[model samples]
Target: MSTHDTRNTRGRGATHMENGSITQHENHTRMREMTQRNQDMERMKEEVIRHVQSRLNEVLERALTDSLQSLSTHTQTHTDKTESTNNRHKLEEGKVFIARCSLLDELFEISHIRTIYHMFIAALFLFIMSTLAVDYIDQGRLVLDFDLFYYAFGQLGTVVWAWTLMLSYTLLGPYHVLRVWGEQALRSRWRTCVCALTLCAAQTSMLGIFPVCVVLHYQLPPASRFIIILEQIRLVMKSYSFIRETVPAVLKNTTQKDKSQRYPSLSSYLYFLFCPTLIYREVYPRNPSIRWKYVGMNFLRILASLFYLYFILVRLCIPVFRNNSHQLFSSRSLILMLFHAAFPGMLILMLGFYAFLHCWLNAFAEMLRFADRMFYKDWWNSTSFANYYRTWNIVVHDWLYYYGYRDFLLLSGYKLRSMATLCVFAVSAFVHEYAFTMGFGFFYPVMFCTFAGIGVVFNFAMNDSRKSPVWNIIMWVCLFIGQGIHVCLYCLEWYAQIHCPRTGTSFWELVTPRSWTCNYQ
Candidate 1:
């Protein structure tokens, strides 16, 4: 019995030992699986961290680049504002003035702008050589005769007399009348009205009736006519400027104490006449000294530009138009002529811009020490017609903006915005058409249609939101086509006028374009 009991105890102990070994093995496997999972979780966390860090670096880099560009642009703009402020802050002993800015002091710091000037100079040289080459090939040798220019500008005596008369009236009559009546404290509405009427009548006679009479009666050539008409507009604009500025102040200070204060000094008025500005001020910012070399260079460029225009017109226009008045008018021929004229048209456009905006204005500005040189902006790089027109001729634009468009807006109490825009376009078109008609001695509605009609269409179509390069290309293409059409059509009309002389002295016959009936005749 003792031996059987002992065996049972041994069996139970073996079973318990087996159970213990199995439990040990299960715990070790569980530990191994948990260790592997922990390692995988750590690896995933490390990868996520790396990815986030890289993204952060990229965003920071882009932000830094953008910040730098903005800073540079702002700095440049600030520099411009600073120079402009410097220009108008002259404290003459007794003279008061408005604060303003100049463009030259800001733009010249950029090296690329100088490069652009050099490029234009190079282009001038190229233009000269190109003209010489064509002349040499056609005429067996170069025959440089500037007789066309000489003849067109031959009778300057008449223009000088007209200018002298206009200048004397502007310098003497209006300035004195404004001061005399303004100082009297008359408070007479009828007197003011009479003075205003007199001034208006005088201005009209000088700018309107007198010029039309001279052009029609004397029958001046195109170039000489341009001188008289442009001067007429210039004088009118200057006179209006003087009145616009001084009259307000005079009326504002209607009190007895303010009456004794002087109108703008005579020297200021004279300076305003010669200065390259259409806006009038009591005192203008002046340079300390004149740069004679700069003046001479601009004048030289003006002469070169004249020759350039001569070359372009002679070589590119005369040959094509000399025989066009005799040819049959067809869509195909018209299209061909337009395409051919495009080259010279562009040249003419560029030359005119350079000659007037840069050379002529800058020369006068330099001589007058007119430091506010914001005459034009960078218009060539414009992507929209709206921007282009604003930048093209800032002086004229300012006049129109301040006097015409703004006044109309004010008069209408800011309503009729579209109508105001249309009015601006109409006035501009009228002036342009008038100038062209008087200069060329014909009424070819080509200038009017392109400006008032097509120009308005484009102004609305290619608006300011179009900032892409594609839009810029389209704008340039349209300019090229428009200019080509203008040149081709004008050349055709000019030739027809010469070839088809008027048989009857009727007003309609004189005003009518000869090109239309010349082909049919």
Candidate 2:
């Protein structure tokens, strides 16, 4: 009985031990699974944190780059605007005086250029000989008659009187007004307006209306009319420059009541009136001494150029155009005439530039011991019409740029540069047309169209970006064609006006171009 009980107890004890081992193994496996699940969750949490950090970094970098780019662009725009404003201010201040010689004067110092000038003199002699020969052949005798010159410059007294009166007014009127206004203790806005109106009215009546009235009332010839009109324009410009340059100083001094401030002297004003430059200044660059010989030589050259122009007109222009009114108009004939006139027109243009801008201005400069002789630049080398206009007639161009274009920009608050450019072109065109109308006694708008229409188109189209030599050639070709058209059309109109009688005594009839309907009987 004891053996059986012992065996049963041992079996039960063994089974209990095996059950305890299985429970221990199951607990170890469960603990290992739980540890692995915790490690996996920690790895996923770390990966998500890294991904979020990377996205935030990308967003910050993009925002920073955009903000920097925006700042840079704004800075550049502000810098450009400031530079533009400064340039405009400098222009308004007045041209800086530099001691320099005229372009042609420097060129004439070269042996080769002097030879070319000698060639012109030789050509003038040849022209004289040809004229003598023609006179001998036609009238069976040699006779020198400058009937054209005499007729062209007929009204000398009227021109002198008008010019004297204009000069007197320009010298005294602006100076007196500025002096009186500047002496005032306090100038009100209404007072300033009154002064301005008074100046404007006086200028309009004396300088503006007087010259035109003289020309029309006396029936001035072409050359006389040109003299009066050109002088009128010059005096007007001079007066305006004087006022423009001094008024600011006057206002400033008067406002501050500066005892040290002094008005421009009478002697300086007198000198300015006679100076070659249109710009007025209290002082000008002067030469150490005047060379009367140089002045004489320049005057002689100007006389020679005048004779050269006369010969060109008689030999090349008159023969072709004098009888043109008798012929019926045709497109082919017009084309041929235009082509034929191109060379002569170009010659005249060069002659005019050389004579007035170079010879005459230089002569006056030498006489006055004026040092600055940069009357013109190398316009012939210009590749664009814009450059050409800037280089050619630098005197007038400076006036126009400072007064017209820059002032317009200031008035517009720098918002419309393109519009300012358009306004400048319009004003220039109007002035040119007015001068031509007054000079020629006709209302031809050819110059106006050329300046406002084709000139504007070319200015934009043939911009400074064009650097190719082909563009230069194209510019020259356009100039040739334009000059040809100007010559041909003006000549035709002049002759047609003579040949064609007016059907009515009306303003329209007078203003209308007679070349449109003149058919010779």
Candidate 3:
């Protein structure tokens, strides 16, 4: 073999050896990279699994805790209710009394709520300024004369006299009758019936008939009539409650042969008559001391409210409706009037509620040192009319629920809850209409139709099932429209009666709405 051929073969062999080593090193490097990737992937997977397990554990723990809390709350509530039921007498099973502050009183403690009150006061100042500006523009002078107030509150002496008589009758008549009846050793069914009849007759004459007759005969102004009629209703309810509460104990005592049971003290009866509560109790939750400052503040608020109402009427209400009766009645005008009246109507409604429910009642409650200041509840928060009715005026509602609704249920053997509710609504509507009719000296049934008809329907429609804020808005809208309708129609009717003279003096003519036929324009 040639020497050159041997050298070339050796070089080729070296080259092949180098290439194989290089290939082996590359393969080892690739294997390490793949192993590192696998380890990283495994670590990531472990982290994901741990995260999932931790989240699941937290969710389970939360669910379990919530379930335990709910169970504990339900058990505690049930225990309290059971204990209360077992301890309370059957007659007093329904009514429960607890000392609590009014919703506004609590809300007013919060700064934000108090700011809203300040806003209302500011708005009232604006109203006063507006009234002054208008008076200057129209009459070249700022008229501050409260002529409407004077007219509405006329015949103060008659109101005072009538109120005194009614109160005296309520204080003396019902208590004496109950005392005399309870003193009987043997309360025979006949005697009981006679006593009941006597009470019914006396209440009808003194509380019911007397106030109506006086208002009609004396030609009392609207405010005076309201005072007398409201007092009349209050005394009536007070008397009924006294008799109802005491008679049950009397019968029970007589049956058990327990002579220790005597009539409730006259002092308690008088206190009940003046207290803010309509439901009568032998003993009530009372405050340790009266806060004169608080009482004074409430009265000041009431006076402010009165001025607020006056401005609302003068600026927003009277200007629109005073001359509206002279215009031809059309649906478009009526609708425009309704919408226009809505703002003022809402203002009036709120003012009425604040003045009467919050201010007046709170003042009286403080003066009496009545511990339970829950004359009303969070009615503004109510999304349903039923809830509103229940919370709006708790004093009257409690009386109606216990005396009127519960009694009807008892009489019907609890088989007619729906019927009982209807009856209660009817009674409330009637009383409202009756009061307005007497106060206004007209037979307008606007309140009656709205209250009994639309009110009942809304009570069922906007039930507790409505929980959304949309429902709340809808409830407020309904209130606005209702108030607008009431204010517009009543105001129109009032002016109509003045502008349109009656052609016939017949009973139907007297009761008929003058706004329907009056075209003074």
Please tell me which predicted candidate would have the highest lDDT against the true structure: 3
Deviating ranges (above 4 Å) for candidate 2: 1-93
**What lDDT score goes with residue 180 in model 3?**
76
Q: State TM-scores per candidate.
A: 0.77, 0.82, 0.82
User: Candidate 1's residue-wise lDDT over 1-521, tens digit each?
Assistant: 69999999999999999999998999999999999999989877876776698799999999997986777687978866775455334210122333243344345544677787778678767767877787799887876677878877867887788778878887887787777667553578788877878777877876678888887788887887888888888888888888888887776666545646666788889889999888888678788889999899889989988887877776678877786657866777789999999888988998898788878888898898887777788787788998888888888988887777767766886557688778888888988998888888888888888889998988888778888989888888998999999999898888887878789989898878787777644
Sum up the clashes in candidate 3: 0
Judged by TM-score relative to the true structure, which candidate is superior, 1 or 3?
3
User: Each prediction's Cα RMSD?
Assistant: 21.2, 28.4, 18.0
Question: Which pairs clash in model 1?
Answer: 84-100, 84-101
* Residue pairs in clash, model 3: none
What C-alpha lDDT, on a 0 to 100 scale, does residue 237 get in candidate 2?
A: 88
The global C-alpha lDDT for each of the candidates, from Candidate 1 onward, is 0.80, 0.86, 0.87
Best-to-worst order by lDDT is 3, 2, 1
**Clashes, model 1:** 2
Cα lDDT tens digits for candidate 2, 1-521 = 69999999999999999999999999999999999999988877876776799799999999998986787687988867777778767755668888999888767755688999788779889989999999899998888788889988998998998899999999899888878777662456776777778889999999989999999999999899999998988898888889988988877876787889899998899898888887789999999998989889888878888888899888888889877656777888889999988988888888889889998998888888899999999988888888988899988888887777777877777567788788889988988888888887788799999999999999988888787889899998888888888888888888887788678879989888888788886
